[model samples]
Target chain A: MRRILSSVTDGRGFDILLVSITMIFLLALSGMPLVYNVVMSFQEVDMFNLNTFSRPYAGLENYREVVSQPEFGLILKNTAFFVFGSIAGQFVLGFALAMFFMMRFPFAATIRGVFLVSWVMPGLVVGALWGWILAGDFGVLNAILKGIGVIDSTMFWKSDPRLSIWAVTIANIWLGLAFNMMLLSVGLAAIPRDLYEAAELDGANGWHRFTTMTLPMMRSTIGAVLALGLIYTLQQFDLFPAITEGGPANSSNVAQYWAWQYSFLLFDFAKGATVSVMMLGFVLIASIVYVWSTRHEVRG
Target chain B: MTPQIEIASVDKHYGAYHALKDINLTIPRGAFTALVGPSGCGKSTLLRSIAGLESITSGNLRIAGTEMSGVPPRKRDVAMVFQSYALYPHMNVLGNLTYSLRFKGFNKEQARKKADEVAQVIGLTELLERYPRELSGGQRQRVAMGRAIICEPKAFLFDEPLSNLDAALRVHMRMEIRALHDRLGATSVYVTHDQVEAMTMADHVVVMRAGVIEQQGAPLELYDNPANKFVAGFIGSPAMNFLDATVAEDGRSARLEIAGKPVLPLARTLQPGREVTVGLRPEHLRIDTAAPRLQVPVRVVESTGSLTYSTTETEPELMIVEQGRGRYRAGETLPLTIAPEDIHLFDPTSGTAL
Candidate 1:
């Protein structure tokens, strides 16, 4: 008893205890829900039997019905577009901004710090703000686009079927931009300044230096940023309801928002669990990629 | 022959703090020059300015025969081996050595051949496929040098490149670097704070202090006839000792004010009754009982098998370094003498060689 108590207080046992606590928490909160969702998807679930653990096994019925739904193809396409569009836009713009702020100028750090406001603000707040700016008639974005002669008429972002999905993507890119930039900035700062000087003396110009030094050194950071972006974009739900609500005939409805609709509004619990299980596969792949990239982070 | 690099009236400023004052230097086509000073003496700033890494506030910098003003580092055709080695962690040894050649449009076969040859010279032949992180500190240093020499650059600049190695490796690499410089006959500029490194590795040594060159010449030239008291004090290993003195009425000798009023003979006639500071190298002072010059008691004695270093118990303690093991102990009085030619006199107020 004394040995066990001592170990728990100050030895390897303490480490194990710390780890098990997190494991228990995750199992109770996240792992159990995931297993339950998968189990519920493979069983016949109804509003009357929702409180019970035992259910009739309905192999592939929920999956088949969910996949055969009329709006499934459209929602899947919208999800793909939103994930890729948001990731691409956020990464490119964030990387550009990170590199720009690396230049020596007064208030450069201060201005970069201000860009983090978007990341810290609640998702609903950001969505509302972007919705206002992306409004069809009185929006600042349209006013500027029209003034610059790029648009003959105002863009109806939320109402149009083709543009409704894009409206949510635009807001997501803004919401995630600061996080991508901050991570990239930390990665950029980790590179020793002497490496750039050495490259300069080795006959490498600005462009060559970037390709050879900056890009290669940032490989791990870029991997982590993209993987996290994919997961985060997949999980985005607040902006959907605030802006288009996956609306205008399900044109903008992504898998996550659609799953929520099936469970709550449409009262189809099995289909909701089925759709969520599919998203869990993508998040798992992204998590693996994130771990693999960071494994080789120790530089010379 | 015209110098390979020439800098005339160069000045550097960081906002209001002046870093490099009007500095003029000339590097010959195949000379190995070292810029050596204590920390914050602008030795590094000057070297960076020469490499075009740091822009000079006002100067005419000429490399070979071309004006280097407003020119970037890549176009200057000069290579630098940084103290940090600065090897690309992502690339293997071969890639690092051949990086510049690739930029210069060399094909894979040609670049690989060049890298192999350079690798062989630096004894990195078997480590070609290994990344920088896999190599030891000394190996990384050699790779940095190999990368610098592969391009056949007009000049080589080293910023304390051997400082990161262990003491034994540092000594070995010092001769290796000098040998490489001789074989290539490349014009090189090295920077170091250790005077010994500058003395051993460089053909011409430029000693700097506070953004100004105190002296520049051959190593022995600076040692034998230092231009100022600072150079005299800085050039030697254990440092030269300075004592308060006054020229005697005889005008041929000076009275050293120590424990005993010892009159030491001078190499040159000085102004009568002139106050001066006398400099004596520790190696030159010897314990002489037969012909005692100054009588002082020993405070401490340290022996290192080959030599003895002792300090005298006096108001202004004088250090003495002598060959062979010394049996002297603390509080033991001993007579010391130095040859008249070995005595150096400096102006007390200006610390200049008189």
Candidate 2:
């Protein structure tokens, strides 16, 4: 008893004790589920076999079925569009906004904080809000487009096959724009002000300074923002279920939503697990990139 | 010598606070000028104005006899060495030195050739490809200087460039910078709060306080004949000591207000019975019992083998510095004397020379 008490208070015993507690909690909660899903993707899972660990080994059969579906091609294209479109929109607009707010003006911080309102909202709530704004008949966006004479007729955004994926992508961009801008702003602020003055005295114009000094100094930050954006966009599930529901013949369906549809809506648990395991590959790569980029920060 | 940079009635204001007021200075070509002052005294603001980093609210500035009214910092053609060194951490030393040259449309080969020449001049030829984070503080300082030198601008503005280094490095870099200025025959304006650096490095020194130029002249000229008490106290180590006194019956002398009321002759005549402030440099004082001009109890004694520093135990304690170690202990009354010509009298109310 005395040894137990002493071990808890000092030496490697305390370190081992702390590590074991967290390790046990993570293994029981996250690690088991993750391993179970990967195992389920390799087996023939059904409602009858859900309760038991042992299942019939299906091998590559589940992966084959998921890839061979008729809507698979369209969903793959839509997923690529949503991921790249959302990330590109968020990053470009976020960087521009971050640079704009860097000027010395009153209410700058307060106004930038106001920009985070859309991001502060939950994804499902933001999707619902954008759903109304992107509605076919009574949408405010179509009304603005008509009022500005950009379009002569009402345009169906969420229901139209061509525009269904774009509606959700736009809403996701709005949701993540503030996150990107805030992260990039912190990166921009970490740079010393005297560097700009020194560059100015060195005969660098605005464009030259931006390219030579600002861009290179923000390498790690841009990497982190891009890597996280990739992961976040991949895991983006709430918006799909809220706005388009992978509607109009799967034109808006993405990897995460399709995985959910195969598991709960269609009751094809193996195919859902198979689809998610594939996405895990991309997220793992992004995580590695994030860690590596941050480890190599160029700050002096 | 012809003036290289000229400022006429310059003033700077940030909203309601005035930073620099009616400052006029002419920096002659190839002359090294030092702006020395306390913090927030507009010395840095003045230097930045010259660099075009900070815009002057009113007045004309001429560099190389050209008007600089609307010229941006990049177009002003002046290089500044910041106190932080501000080397680009992302770039290697070679990249840093050649960045401005590249902007000026230097081809890759031309830029590399120029970088080589600058690296050789700055003693960083060995570390050309090393990033700033990999270099030590002194090496980074040399990179900043090299970056400034490669451009060969109209003038160089240094904002306390050596303030970040250790004491020994600060002194060594001080001489190296002065030597570089002399060898290049480049016009330079250095700003520092350390008067010793300004005295030793600059041929001309401008002392400023409260947004006003208190005095400007040769380093020793300002040291020997300060226009005001502020300049007098600011321009020397250990600082000049001030004591309140009443002029004696004779207009040429004044009696000290300490315990002994010891009397000393003034350098210049003052009205008899006038209240004046006596300014005596600490180094000018000595222990002279035979001709005792001051009798005060010592408060503290410090010895550094080559010098003795003592403070008197009085309301406004006076500091006395003497060459070499002389026995001095706390609570001991010490008699001191000063030559009549070494005495400085000031008008007590205005803090100006009498």
Candidate 3:
């Protein structure tokens, strides 16, 4: 009787142990920042009164305040411009590079090796290098422009409100081009050589082959690259912070940078949490739309 | 219409390796010529060169009296069916057939009409609306044929088109292709490693080995009179068996001695005491019990419904094909007889037919 009782206790203990381990793994995975952000977005907490151990609830008040801010509207608009502008430049340049690589040329391998270097570098390092290159005073670009007599005087690149957005966009485009090029190059190579042979037999010249064969065959690849680009560009914060610091009177500030400023720098925890929550919502909506548009391609 | 294709002294090289060497062929118009050889024999390369897919290193290919040295595949007015079918995955069967027509300046209605006509001919009219992935292997094969025929190109090039099908389907498709050729009377150059396909489908067969043409003639001509031992061994099913022998004096006949048994009076006129190889086909050997016969110990026996093949352990291992049920048992000494006229004699040194 005692042995039977002991075995029952041991089985119960084993079940409890398995349940605990599984719960820990799940909390680490899907329960970390996503749930924390949700909980904190509804909590009422001030910067000075912040206690890491405290529990508080505000019930949508933070969300309401965040939406009512005047800067929030401008931040949203700037984010849109940054995402779309960066993605467009990256795709165009990347696609061109991919096409160039596809040609049968000497030193093609060497060129691919050189292009891969930029993508492999840390994003922080890329931002820092571009920041120096785009600096207004004593920068190489301004010096070269002045020396060549293209411009009469040195122009401030980061400080000027009109040019700051363009400078940031240029930096992001350079950093993002490598990704698009590599992916599209793979797509181009995956197409069967026989298709091209067949198309040529069908009387398709260079332009006809490109429009009818190359473009249509690359539809799934293009859709995948564009969708990924949109998502990655939407959450962009590193380049703006490292290079421009959302500076020149906040003219180039994106939503992610704004969220970081409210949460970390300003110590307005409630409002910062609200901003983070809104950014999450925006990302989810964009991803959902992208998936819906490319469902057929994904299935294929 | 006599649409002759002549490839004169054509040579192709890939870097340092010579792919094709001095290949010369004449394919008469409306004749179905098959290039038959093992893989890497440059048969497909030669076919692609004819289709203008690969540029020849030297020499000229003339189709209907026009030199096609610098012509591209599109301007050559020839169509090709690849082994993989190479159908456009995104397009349905109808779209696949009409894709080339659009580039040829045919309007949508006209292209569809032509596609439908070819689809009916290839028995793919019911499958026009289905995608390539949705169709079975045989259906996709028919669609590929439809795509090639819809353009009505001057010549058709097939690179092992029926290789991907099952054995039964391959046989069925082979007959379909033959029927299609009869109806269209299109000049075609087909490449395959299967000797049966070459013998059955080709009006003329070109046997190749090591980047050179061993022999080229009508199928029956090659079977009856192979120029060399290589052609003789490669052109027949169950392959011709060769035995070492020496010619008898007076140059009238050859004597082949196998397993201490004298099988003499082989019909050949060679110098006396000259070494030679005697060739025999399995079907020519008959199992006889009446008169004096060449005795052979049977090694293995395979019985099909129509014929029985028995392998014998002689000087050169021989395969014997007999009609109907064969009463010969394994491990038994069987008496076999060969007709005097059915013998093929070859020179021992040069391996050429005497």
Candidate 4:
């Protein structure tokens, strides 16, 4: 009896030690950035001054000053257009492509393999390639347009302030398409063939089956894709910097680039952290709404 | 209304593998025809082909005198109850039943009215507003049936609709399906591997083997006179027992010699000295003390509440189903008798009845 009790205690001790180690690793992973961000956003700091590690709270002044900037509203609007436009475009095109590939067609596997290349390519590489392609002079697009006699001469594609947002939006759409397509494709494949057969027997044609069966079955995947797309697009900085650099006259400046400008370019870390915190808040609220609306679809 | 579904020399292939071969069958109007076979026997494939879920490689199919060869499943006017129930997870029970009707051009009011009628018939009126996830397995099955029945299509296709339920629920649902068929009198094609379900619910059972029809007949006809040994073995529970035998000099009756001791008589005509297989159902074997037909040593004894099963090993292993009680112990020799009328003889080379 004593031996058995001791062995049981030994087993429980190992379990407790394992749980403690896991909790320590989790705290190191999740708690570090949260604590750093909270501290930096609340403190008055600058790039030139190294006081972020030891600064005191400035009581929402940083947030107030950040919001009082002239370009804040414009940046917010550009961020909204970039995120919403890119996500919407990716979803529509990606879902359509996914459905197309889902059908029984020849060389579908080869086509899918080709489509996946864009997703596996690095974001920097994609931005650089699009940057060269959208260049005003000696660009393939302008050359084609001129060759087709659609335009008299090469136009300033990325330099024009009016078309800069669209230029950035197009690049982001291309980058995100393959991700959405792969996710929605897996979701579509998981649906049983019997459901489609049953629906067909129930007087549902191809369109009806897609709307009722495919759409509902892919709801959770759509939600995940949309949420991730929204979050990534809202925090987008790499592609814009490489492609347009938030020009002409900051027409394509998103929240993340604006925040980077404040911190690194303008040397106001407090205001940049303030912008970051605000963007994070918006993302959290949007995510919460997305999760709440899609709760039933997820469970079902 | 007479139900009429006909398939003429339908052929279907998947790459090099022939999933279905030169299949021809006619399900009479208002008849419940069951496609019964083991898994991968193309029973479901045949049902799907009839439902137009699968395209036929060749030949013609018709329902209600209209060609169904190129028609889609929806236009074929047939409703299928999938094995998984396939209830729309997002929709409530009422929504599931009414969703298809809207596409069929039924107005919202008419669809709702039809859904209500179906709900009442299936005893799912209370669960109509609830979602599929909220319902039990049996309730979901009823909802699936209700979804199919609400369409009032020309024929109903049931693809192992009750296989998901537990044994007790399956039995209950089987009876319910039979009653539903009797009342609706719909031309139904049901696919199931379980012979009991086919035997109980089907007006005609089409036994398929390797994508070909082995036999097609009424349940009792198939039981009483099997066309082949596969049907004989497949139809009954505990399965029919087979032993090597030779035709006697009389030609009409054959001698089934077991363990070189007990020789049983089978009522079938065969060439004398010809090797044949003798089949006997477990229920036909009885425990006799005085006039024992065949004796064998008991191997295993299983006692259920109603009936007892004693598995015996003679020259060939056999299962003996007896009523009430079994006094035989393991390794104990017991006398087993089968009535000559119940005996079945099949050609050893080809599994065909003599």
Using DockQ as the measure, which candidate wins?
A: 1
Q: What TM-score does each model's chain B reach against the true chain B?
A: 0.98, 0.98, 0.97, 0.96
Q: Point to the candidate with the largest lDDT.
A: 1
Candidate that beats the other on lDDT, 1 or 2, i.e. the better one: 1
Candidate 1 displacement at residue B303 in angstroms:
1.3
- Candidate 1 local lDDT, residue A29: 100
Candidate 1, position A248, lDDT: 92
iRMS (Å) per candidate: 0.7, 0.9, 2.0, 1.4
Better of 1 and 4 by TM-score: 1
- The sequence of per-residue lDDT tens digits that candidate 2 reaches over residues B1-354 is 999999999999999999999999999999999999999999999999999989999999999999997899999899999999888888888988988897688999999998999888879999998999899999999999999989899999999999899999999999999999998899999999999999999999999998999999999998888888999999899999998999999888998786668789877777899998889999999898787877889999998989999999976889999889867688998889998888888888998887
lDDT of 4 by residue, B195-240 (tens): 9999999989999999899999999999999999999999999899
The lDDT of each candidate is: 0.93, 0.92, 0.85, 0.86
Q: What is the lDDT of residue B46 in candidate 2?
A: 96
Candidate 3 matches the true fold with a TM-score of 0.90
Off by over 4 Å in 2: A1-7
RMSD after CA superposition, every candidate: 1.2, 1.5, 4.3, 3.4
lDDT of 2 by residue, A38-155 (tens): 9999999989999899999999999999899999888889988998999999999999999999998999999999999988899999999999999989999999999999999888
**What lDDT is reached at residue A173 by model 4?**
92
Of the candidates numbered 1 and 2, which has the greater TM-score value?
Answer: 1
Model 1 native-contact share: 0.86
Model 3 C-alpha lDDT per residue in residues A103-145, reported as the tens digit of each score = 9889996897699887788767888888898888877778888
